[model samples]
Target: MSDSPHSTDGDTSRATLARVAEQAAVSMSTVSKVLNGRPGVAAETRARVETLLSEVGYTRRGAVVPGAPLIEIVFSELDNEWAMELIRGAGATAKLNGMGLIVTQSGTRHAPDPEWIDEVISRQPFGIILVMSDLPPANKDRLRRLQIPFVLVDPSGNPAPDVPSVAAANWDGGLQATNHLIALGHRRIGVIAGPHDVMCARARVSGYRAALESAGLPVDDDLVQPGDFHIEGGLVGGTALLESRDRPTAVFATNDLQAIGVYQAARALNLRVPEDVSIVGFDDLQFSNFSSPPLTTVHNPLYEMAREAARILLDIRAGSPVGTGRRELGTSLVVRESSVGPA
Candidate 1:
């Protein structure tokens, strides 16, 4: 057989594979095992082979292999309603396109575990949708070499530029929420912000500050409290703000869960909703509407973002060009009974 390199239909060349195997000091059979996602290879050996494969730019056929009609969705955890909304959205889209959905929970917000990519290669799904999760460079290289497409549903608001992603307009949501409070004749507004490390949280805080400044109100540093996007964070932050000698008439919690915590804090302090202190929250979660004196919050459009991310992944899989590979959905304010004009 001729050793001259050539590619047909985007499949890796045989000569190139031979070179990769030689450099890794492995036989062609061992390389084939790694390429096919078969067992019997040592972990270190597999990683070395994968790195070499990536270095040589070995890519599989672009077309999906026969019998693998699956689209996988990855999340850090599945305990909350947020994950459920995303699953529903992506699952619906996948079914409509004649594919099954696979849900995987692995790793933290930064990236998935090292072995997760190997499992994915074995499955060889049609595409992948990652919600609030990222992949390391080696894993990314493996996916590229396999011609598998992936998209991120990034509520965190920080996504890699080269990858396709869909995110909500978090800053705009924050601005709208704060503006609503100001329009209700509130002179002092407090914000319970999410973790400072997250881009979405920082963007929301910036928006709140902008709204206060634009409305000719002072941006009091004391009114800005740290949170963790959870009820406990909200409770702690809300308690601190409410206990102050000169407390804010209105408060904005970065997320719905935090807002609920604020409610608990207010109740413990013997305050009535929207009477003693008006409140607003972000995310517009389903439970937000069921709270005593329903929550006035921002509609985050999590379901829509998931659907769009799945669509983009499918489009990439179909060999279509996606310009910029980034989409930001708009947010709207949902007025409920929880916020009112300060007395």
Candidate 2:
């Protein structure tokens, strides 16, 4: 093999596998494995070497060098059931396409680390998928500068025109849930919306208003409460709604987790679901059907959404057009024991 470093210019010499190995604190053979896109190198080690190379300004000289197409998926958190389903779907699609999926959690922060992004780009991944909520402006700018193919999944706010995305029909799901209650003669409907800034939350709220408007019912501002998309937040919000003198006959929660919290709130207030009050939730997570009364919820295809996003990234890498900018899948309501006519 050629170990001699090539001279790039008057004063700088081209980086070699040995130099990268030394800088990354690994054996030269390991560096060669990564440089030539060979297998056997651990994911974390590969990322380290890739980051080192970029930090030292090393550029590989070749065309279409082949192996597994490394793709990094950055997520805001991994604690949620929906997020786990999304990961599983994306991972399966990546495997089918002969690509490797690297999942990294960004703590509770909104944006990913700039160094991490540099590492990902240095590895020359086939593509990237950002499954995050409200990525900061600085991170967006950095991503734009990388000039690599990428797609966003569940972006919480407006995204740059260049970045493509795949999302669910959240507004329609919300509208459907609200309309279902309205049709059951529930005029005093309360809303337990998720985080105020989250895109899904905002869309669901919009749908709720639309349903009320269609039914000629005035939107009651006092009946609506914001939750942090967590069970505890739901419990607090649900309790407040239940304690009101003019309690709503039915309630619509933005997610299954929140809906579960509402169940607790109902028990605390000595109210039986669908008998004294009705409840409907979104995102039919695994446990939704097993809830005390079996939640009536809108089914969000989390796994399908993830798979579609991965497929789109693969297409982009292959230089094939994956249709237009953004793609949105539909949602449907699942009737269960949690909802019925207003009492």
Candidate 3:
């Protein structure tokens, strides 16, 4: 004999359409019609059953629901105060736009991890903000494959053709700082540059050299040293520069942390700032103004840069094309007692 429509062949224990119908408080035929996507079931009945299916954790074969998209912010380093400030600015903007932020760390190794890109893609974030040092071609390709929108903050080299970026006017700031020292009659000027691989460091070095060349002064190789954008590196670099017989009348360190290191080195050497050797630094950090003689440095809007980056990411997520892929913010020279007429 033929089996009943709601029954399986001799398997009464198995759940069939009738069981689902009973649990959903609907007729067996109505459940059958809805399950088959037929035209007879009422819209309200269909919705009720669907809700029950979800609540009961039913997984229909070959079914998927689009998830909520998110945004990811990737940073190269998280230990520094500057990094913290950037996160605060980005976080504020993200919150304002009602978008979630997925913060990830890309180590200081050779390059960012391709696994990170894959993980980001798996999460299906609406966009990404790269606060990393520099991305290699492999990672870039992975990002391309995922088709995820991204913006870069303080990126190296020129902005990628399709990706938007925001950065400070580092080169111009360097020139301003160097020219300020030149105006003070500092013929023998020294520079403690950040790591060579860093784009900002390279740009500042270029600006410093340009200023010297523009002033008809020879660029002295002995007066320039490599600093790792750290206080200890600055201390070592400063000590080496100060110990030279032809010591510089003025010194320019890449950042305020380095500038503080310069101060410590000078104190050890019994050299009074501005009186014996004028000193200037970049990035007017919080403590720069509280130093012994108050550091004279270049003021770049770091928080503003981060905020703009977040805004750009939000716009991208909103399906708006960024008019310009690159934004370069300005910088100003902050004059203070730490720098004065060359002794």
TM-score for all models, in order of appearance: 0.87, 0.78, 0.73
Residue-level lDDT of model 2, residues 177-295, one tens digit each, is: 99999988899999998886687788998999999999999998998998887889779989999999999989999888999999999999999998988999999998999998999
What's model 3's TM-score?
0.73
lDDT of each: 0.84, 0.76, 0.73
Clashing residue pairs in candidate 3 (N, C-alpha, C atoms within 3 angstroms)? none
How well does candidate 2 score on lDDT at residue 152? 78
Candidate 3 weakest lDDT stretch, 10 residues: 59-68
Cα RMSD (angstroms) for every candidate in the order listed: 5.1, 7.3, 12.7
In model 1, which regions exceed 4 Å deviation? 1-29, 38-67, 323-325
Tens digits of lDDT, candidate 1, 82-197: 89889899999989998899999988887876678878887778788888636787777767666678888887888887788899898998999999999989999999999866
Please provide, for model 3 over 231-258, each residue's C-alpha lDDT reduced to its tens digit, 9 standing for 90 to 100.
9877999999998998998889978888
Task: lDDT winner between 2 and 3, please give it.
Answer: 2
User: Order of candidates by TM-score, top first?
Assistant: 1, 2, 3
- Choose the strongest candidate by TM-score: 1
Which one wins by TM-score: 1 or 2?
Answer: 1
- lDDT at position 127, candidate 2: 64
Which residue pairs of candidate 2 clash?
A: none
Query: Residue 111 in model 2: shift from native, Å?
Result: 1.3
